[model samples]
Target chain A: MNYIEHTGKYFAMLKQIFRKPQKWIIFKESLFREMEDIGINSIGITAFISFFVGGVVVIQMALNLENPFIPRYLIGYATRMSLVLEFSPTLMSIILAGKVGSYITSSIGTMRVTEQIDALEVMGVNSLNYLVLPKIIASVVFYPLLVTLGIFLGIYGGMVAGVLTDLISMPDYITGLRTDLDPFHFTYSMIKTVVFAFVIATIPAYHGYYVHGGSLEVGRAGTKAVVWTSVVIIVLNYFLTQMLLS
Target chain B: MIEVKNIYKGFNGVEILKDVSAVFENGKTSLIIGQSGSGKTVFLKCLLGLFETEKGIISFDGRNYAELGIKVRRKLREEIGMVFQGSALYDSLTVEQNVMFPIKMFKNSSQKEMLIRVNEVLERVNLEKSNKKYPSELSGGMKKRVAIARAIVMNPKYLFCDEPNSGLDPQTSTLIDNLIHEITVENNITTIINSHDMNSVMEIGDKIILLKDGYKVWDGTKDEVFYTDNEAVTSFVYSSNLFKKVREVYTGNIKL
Candidate 1:
């Protein structure tokens, strides 16, 4: 349909998804399964990407600020600021929008095509609430922890890279990290992470839940879910930064 | 008994079911047979309350379906069990877990009690030793049996099957048909099966409703099916050369 129709349908779906679950025990079990799927399964990729990106950021800063007047400690300070303010929250979520987003879409889409979702509905279960809400809860609850790990590993990687390259000493880098630590920046990063996590979980679910046709359509929905999630995250990143940091 | 009264269903302003009406009785296997695109699925979905009709009434055991509130509708759903055409077993869950799912959702029975019920239904479906196997590990007929076990695990009052014999070999198809018929008789469930399988139609169809191009052209018992001169029914039932011969032999038109 058109953009307005899609927007209306999305809000309508959210309304359905937020209902009280039929059975709390089942909901709890699904929630735990989702947490493992969305959070724990993502550790390796998050760590690998964050660590390498952190090192690359430090190297770029060191090379760009190579001048007699500019302080060497600025390299560490810039790495810390960039990662805490934008990289860990926004960039990490964009990656998850691709990784986790496609997974949710394809899985839910598969269920839709195969009539598993219909079976749930036939069984008097709220299919949307049972399938999507758990993912939303899991991502919102554990994404912050995942992003926190991103921030820590990212900063550590920067420290390691800077010390190994002799571009900046460990003590100077440590001092730069502590130079102007504002608790709110971390809070801002967290707020952004939470928002993006919701987007990552829900957009994909929306795509999957509404998927029609068969396997070919499911694949198309997965692609569309990832693309729309990334787009929404980027747009929301700008707006959130404006609201929270300004 | 499920009473459908002049129900009409449409999608995107295109009429799919055109004022179709029929009564399905309890403890009997009623089959809705139609060609592809004849709206049999829509009719079945309408009966299952998966699709809301634009007009007319469907009452289950004297209670109007459309008039029921959301909570009441859901409560009604707990009494309804559906076996989808694809046998939509949850791929991630093993056969035991899949069969136990509806019970786990709706009943507060103890784990031991639940296992007993699950095993009882599984054994009834002749799937005694296949609890740990996943859907992917099972053959087509086995998967359909698992789906049946899951559908009946809650001891539902109504059981609906959509094309249950679609993709099985003739022996397996007959086996599935007999299993469904036996279950209906044993549980006294108002079983409604949507199928184009003439074999299944002849075997277990206590009542057969024929839909052609969104209309109920003819409906009767298996014996009446042979005697009726309804063009739509004959065209559909005796469509193939093999069925034409079976009809001839059954009617004593020529020596076997």
Candidate 2:
């Protein structure tokens, strides 16, 4: 489909997601299952990426500040800004768009291909509500916590870099973290994360749930899910930064 | 009973089911038999409400499906149990959980009651001890049995089986056919089976519709197959040499 048609269908799918579930208790069961699948299974990767990326940002900043007049404490300040303003929210969400995003698409796409959705439809089980709502709720609930963890690990990794490499001291890093803490920056980051969480859940679901054909289409759906989610995340990151941080 | 009148279904302006009408009565197996592209699946999907037809009146138990609201449609949905061609049991759930799924979704029964119902259907399908096993752990025939058990666990009044014997050996195919037939009779479900399996048709088809190129060309029982001169029905049923020999013997055209 063209861009307009795709956007229209995406909104249409979201509209159906809000329809009443076939049963709340059964939906509750799916919610917990998907919570574990999206949140618990994802923390390790989120943490690993957050820590390493934080260290890299510190190193990059130190290398760029060749001027002798610049203070070493600025490295920590920049790291804090980068983590809270960008890396922890935006980068972590992009990573999730690849990791959790592909998973949701592939699993749902496989179900669609195998006639499992058809089975649910015949049973009068509102397949969209049964499939997508739980994943959306799980991601919305837990992804911000993941981003919060990302923020913590990011700063901690920067501190480790500072202490080990002598670019800045732990005291200086701690001071920078506390010096210019704008509460709105954290709120803005969360607002972005919440939006990202919804994108991560629903975009992939749209690709997967509407997929036609067999296993090949399912695989294509997964690939397309990752691509579309990454694009949407990046585009939304830009717009959200403009709207909120400006 | 279900009555379909002048049903028309299409995709991208290409008609797949054209003016098809038939009556599927309770306590009998109604078979929709056609070639791969003859739109039997489309017709079945229309009956199941999975596909919306451009024009048709499908009356299930004297209520028009298209006229009903979502609430009433859902109420009717609880009475439908479908056995998919791929035996589409949830891969994540165990056999028992798969069987219990519909019961849990449609009824407000407690755990004890649901488990009892699950086990009862499993036993009816002769799959008592396989509850803990997953779909991947079951053989093809065993998977079909489990699908049947899952379909019937809710005691649905209308049962739909789509190509139930597609991937089974001949003996196992007969077993699946007989199991569905016996359950349909015992429970008095309005069973509609879409199959290419002529063996299933001859063995259990109480009423059958033959379709070709998006139109219903013939409708009758197994006994009528032996006497009918309709080329579409005969060519489809006697497409095999074995069936040809059996037909010749039955009609006294050749000595055995």
Candidate 3:
């Protein structure tokens, strides 16, 4: 399609989406499914990886401070900065691109190739509103929640390592976290996460909604949605942080 | 009733319909028949406003389709129902939900009323016990029936069927033809079907328009078609082996 044709379709989809936002039961269902599948269910894997990541960070810090020139409690400052600035938003987005992005792409692509979308058009139902809006809404609503949980668990992981490894006293670690953590960094992370969520949700939905061919094409679209969205999320995360914090 | 006047449509600089003008009357099954690539489907889509015609006017129920606003176009769509070449039922929805789709979109009926209407239409199409089944589970014929049930559930004033019997067995095709014809007559709907099937043409052809190379070559009733001297019509009518065998039988050239 040419630019004009593509723009026309885009506007038509937007108009349809806004026409009847209330009649979005299917979107709500898909959103709930995305949250459960992407956010809630992936918590275990996120926790495990974050625990090891924290352990690695603390061990490296302890070894570097072996000369006793640097304060041992500064490990908490380093952990807090890394988790708030990069790890939470970036890793959570990667996980969600795999989990929720794949689901949205596959489901919408199947609907497109199966003539279900055409059926909606013939019935005067807007396929975009029925298919894409829910995913967009779900991503915007749940991605921040996931990022928040990731940050908390990530910090807790570092605390467990610091206390169990006896590298730093428990009181020292607690006081370090309280003093080093900046509320502004947490806010910035959340803002970046929301932007990443928009990119992750919209890109996959766009690719899937326009998909043609049969099952093979749907599979290709699902893979493409995940790969492209993850790349965009990482690239955009850098720019968003620089723009917001610099 | 629907009227198409001097409509010209083309894709990629190749004309599919050139100056095509025809009238589809109410309470009759109007068929547009032609060989493959004869632009019957394109013309039907043009009539339905799915494609914009390059030139000319299409009026549905006396409203100029080209001049109507989006709201009016949507209102017109509400009174129109289409059964696509494929059954086009939503795979995720049950049979009952498929039939209830249009009603939900354009009607203000209560759940009780909607269910009653859905069951009535399903029973009308002889698909009573299959309400909860998905489209994947239904046979081809059953799926078509469900599509028909969905099309008519809203009591649309206009019905369009594109090759309604295309992929069915001969017996099932006849059954579908008879059902479409019966429904058209009973409801007084303006139905326009696009097909090249001679069986369907002869079975329910209240008004048949034959197209050849983007031009309407013949327009008449089924019985009237037998007496035409047009060579294209004669060749098409006699091309079937059954008609050829019947011709031989009448001429005493075969021992029947």
- Winner by TM-score: 1
Q: Which numbered prediction scores highest in lDDT against the true structure?
A: 1
Give the better candidate number (1 or 3) by TM-score. 1
Please state the error at residue A50 of candidate 2 in Å.
0.7
Per-residue lDDT for A52-146 in model 3, tens only? 77667766776677867766777777777787788888877887788778878887888887666766766666667766666666777877887
lDDT of each residue in A126-218, candidate 1, tens digit only: 999999999999999999999999989999999889899998999889888988889999999999999999999999999999999999999
Clashes of 3: 0
List runs of model 3 lying over 4 Å from the truth.
A1-16, A20-68, A72-76, A157-176, B229-231, B234-239, B246-256
- How large is the interface RMSD of each prediction? 0.7, 0.9, 2.4
lDDT of 2 by residue, A1-246 (tens): 798999999999888889888777899999999999999999999899888888888888888986989876788889989999998888899889999999999899989988999998888888888999999999999999999999899888878876798877787778877877799999999999999999999999999999999999988999999999989999999999999877
Q: Order of all candidates by lDDT, from best down to worst?
A: 1, 2, 3
Each prediction's total of clashing residue pairs, residues at least 3 apart in sequence or on different chains, is 0, 0, 0
Query: Model 3, B70-139: lDDT tens per residue?
Result: 7678778778888888888887789998898788767777889999999999999999999999999999
Each prediction's TM-score versus the true structure:
0.99, 0.98, 0.86
lDDT of 1 by residue, B120-193 (tens): 99999999999999999999999999999999998889999999988899999999999999999999999999
Better of 1 and 2 by lDDT: 1
With a 3 Å backbone cut-off (N, CA, C), the pairs that clash in candidate 3 are: none
lDDT of 1: 0.94
